[model samples]
Target: YYQEEFAIRRTLISCLDWCDILRIWDVDALL
Candidate 1:
């Protein structure tokens, strides 16, 4: 159970990181 929880947390963090990168790219494209 602990390992599963850790994996889920890591996946969430990675997804958030990707979202931030995409947002930055979108802003740069608009400019």
Candidate 2:
């Protein structure tokens, strides 16, 4: 159970990180 929760949390964090990276790229492209 604990391992499953940890995996979910890690996946969520990576998804958020990817979003942030994409946002930054979008801003850079606009500039």
Candidate 3:
């Protein structure tokens, strides 16, 4: 269970980072 939680946390971080990058690109395009 500990390992599963660690994996989930890592995945969430990666997803958040990807989302941030996408948002930045979208804003740049709008500007």
Candidate 4:
């Protein structure tokens, strides 16, 4: 159970990074 929970947290962090990258790309395009 602990390992599964850790994996889920890592996946969530990865998605957050992707979201940040997308936001930055959008801002760059706007500029």
lDDT of model 1 at position 15 = 100
Error of 4 at 25 (Å): 0.3
Which segments of model 2 are wrong by more than 4 Å? none
- Count backbone clashes in candidate 4: 0
Model 3, position 19, has a per-residue lDDT of 100
Candidate 4 has its poorest 10 consecutive residues by lDDT at 1-10
Residue 8 in candidate 3 has what lDDT? Answer: 100
lDDT for every model? Answer: 1.00, 1.00, 1.00, 1.00
Q: For candidate 3, list the clashing residue pairs, or say none.
A: none
> What local lDDT does model 1 show for residue 13?
100
Clashing pairs in 4: none
- The worst-scoring run of ten residues by lDDT in candidate 1 lies at 1-10
- How does candidate 3 fare on TM-score? 0.86
1-31, model 2: which lDDT tens digit per residue? 9999999999999999999999999999999
- Residue 18 lDDT, candidate 2, scale 0-100: 100
Pull out the clashing pairs in model 1: none
How well is each residue in 1-31 modelled by candidate 4, as lDDT tens digits? Answer: 9999999999999999999999999999999
* Best TM-score among the predictions, by candidate number: 2
Clashes of each: 0, 0, 0, 0
TM-score of each: 0.96, 0.96, 0.86, 0.94
C-alpha-based local distance difference test score of model 4: 1.00
